[model samples]
Target: MTDDLPVLRGLLASGAPLTWVFTGDSITHGLIHTRGARNYVDHLHELIRGDAGRVQDTVVNTAITGWRADLILGDFARRVTHWRPDVVTLMIGTNDCTTQWLDPVIEVTAFAASITEVVRRARDDGGIPVLQTPPTVDLHHAPDRARIGEFAQAVREVAAREGVILVDQHAAFTAFSEGTGPGNDDMAWGLLDDAFHPNAAGHALLALGWADALGFDAVSSPVRTDLAARVAVARHPQWPPA
Candidate 1:
């Protein structure tokens, strides 16, 4: 509704085949937290190819475990540009908040600079850049990284200043936490596998946000609700079978 992804919509609406490259840290990598389940990009891949009838659309995931924006820049061309993607999705800043032995300001400043550089390089290399803010974490368990909110703020600023397509995953997760976050123990609000990494359900939320932003009719997809539906079985006995 806000016209956030006009360029991407144009590409999709044009009905021409296009490639999308996803790069970021473990969150985007669909690490152990996903427990062998598909990540958000996988869901998007299905939407673009199967649902949207764009069978030729390509989705590549070059995300790495424990990597940050600075680390991605170290080998940008290989991980991103080499694919000659039409759209490049960046969902970083989580690990940037936890980098060891660096001042908070320094880490965020470097993170912002690295993000900016990635956007510039993506645009220069003929790719539309899409920025996704890192999702929320359980501060009670990750007390050391309590200031992660600052990093989210930084991503918002970067998105606004860069004038690129913005997907506010952090805001979405934050709203979820505010509404249904457990009173205690389940600090992650049942969305994360641990204190940080998102689990399958969390990944579904991420997918839903991206899908909605990319103008997909996501409400009917398993990616839009409890992803466990795709598991072919209900997560709890109290719930009906998927």
Candidate 2:
């Protein structure tokens, strides 16, 4: 999270009501494995409301499972502009990076274009767009993790060109997985519900990133780590029944 995003800074300082639209794929939806509540969007909404003195916000999740960037594009008009969101976070690209279904180059290129259009639409509709790099995938199943990086870079480039806030969730997940920074520990494995969809702990990481980007004081680092640990331990397959 950087301090240079004037648009986001303005949004935070206004202290007015805000409608936040989160659009992405399964990860954003946090489906079957997470039961929805544990996803980052939900956690972020909760954190926003917890701070009584902060901005009053309405968070809406319009993400669908197994959808690509094109599909999301089709719904943007109806799902986003129609709702008139104040802030929009777009976090797609996982399905777009699939190795088997489509041409990687074609898919990624389309993805980038779609994301750029999404940002444009959001801004045109009087909303500030926050572009998020997709979280890293499990290397075991996703051998072409490099493709993921390419897609993430595309998001970064789009954010730079569009002058919108960019949250580097991919980097955050990598750091968390590697345990490289201060208070960072090995929490990546437990973060995943499977090879793809992130579990509760994983979503917390995303929530923290978004919170940090928005300059919110909610959910401290230690708290996030503890929460991840709790989720991992409680849900570990070998744990005895209560």
**Among all candidates shown, the one with the greatest lDDT:** 1
Sequence-dependent TM-score of model 1:
0.86
lDDT of 2 by residue, 1-242 (tens): 33336766676777778888998888888778675456788777667665434445788999888777778778778768978998888888888887767654446677789899988888889888888998878766666544888899999988887677899988877765453333324335656776667877778777778777877644344445555565446333331114
Task: Kindly give the stretch of ten consecutive residues in candidate 1 with the minimal lDDT sum.
Answer: 232-241
Local distance difference test scores for all models = 0.77, 0.73
- lDDT of candidate 2 at residue 196, scale 0 to 100: 66
On residues 164-198, what C-alpha lDDT tens digit does candidate 1 reach at each position? 77889888777654434235332435567778888
What candidate 2 gets wrong by more than 4 Å, as runs, is 1-4, 35-37, 52-56, 103-105, 144-146, 179-187, 218-242
lDDT comparing candidate 2 with the true structure: 0.73
Question: lDDT score, residue 89, model 2?
Answer: 87
